[model samples]
Target: MSFKYRFAYYLVGFVLGSFFVAAVLTGKDTRCNYFPNARVLNDLRNKPFEYSKEASTVLAENWIDTTDIKNTLTYGDVDFDKSNIKFENGKIYIVEGKTVKNQAIELKVINYTSKAVLKEIKKK
Candidate 1:
């Protein structure tokens, strides 16, 4: 077979394989949450969240709101070194991100079975 013919066959196979994979994964939430940070953040995002008194107070004082908190959780970096993953009640995760106004913020969240509790919030 000529080089051109072989190249055409390979290109066709690649395109077909790509299409097959895309069709199989279309309309599906096939997100890869394999890493600890991604898995923890995804788990926390899925569950409903409650704010503690301290957290709420910080939010109000800093001109931040629940929306900002939610955004931070959705796009924050978890500080595993400062988090207590083996707490007796539940795992506590410290997530650091910025507010909508570009103000830096940090959130301490405790993950429970049913819901997550925003234990603390601070402007950083």
Candidate 2:
């Protein structure tokens, strides 16, 4: 139509397009756990059961046997001593040992988003 009208319409379209693009880019969704670098995921996957101080405490308190702890690494459904489990910063700490008096192995789950433990699967 008129030059002034065309200019106004173009300006409005540009503003609206910018807003749409910003919304799409800024919207939150499930982010890949391997953020900043994918190598962290590889590292975590390679050794998911590394011990931490808290993990050690949980394991020692929970009476999870060493063999059972190892089984958890490969098996999906190793029974966890819930009393010895704790969660922090999207990671799960599981303590496994034969008894409270024995040394407990710490099982750390990397990149765990949810606090709930997934059902353990039997070892094949």
Predicted candidate 2 versus true structure: per-residue lDDT over 18-120, tens digit per residue: 9998899788653454442233333333553444455455546535544555544433222244322444545443322222344334344533442233222
lDDT of 1 by residue, 1-124 (tens): 9999999999999999999999999969899888888888888999987889988777777479788888888889999899868666789999999888999989989998889999988889
Please report how far candidate 1 places residue 21 from its true position, in Å.
Answer: 0.7
Runs in model 1 lying further than 4 Å from the true structure? none
lDDT of 1 at 75: 86
Worst 10 residues of 2 by lDDT: 115-124
Models, CA RMSD each = 2.1, 13.5
On the 0 to 100 scale, the lDDT of residue 70 in model 2 is 50
lDDT of the structure predicted as candidate 1: 0.88
Error of 2 at 62 (Å): 6.1
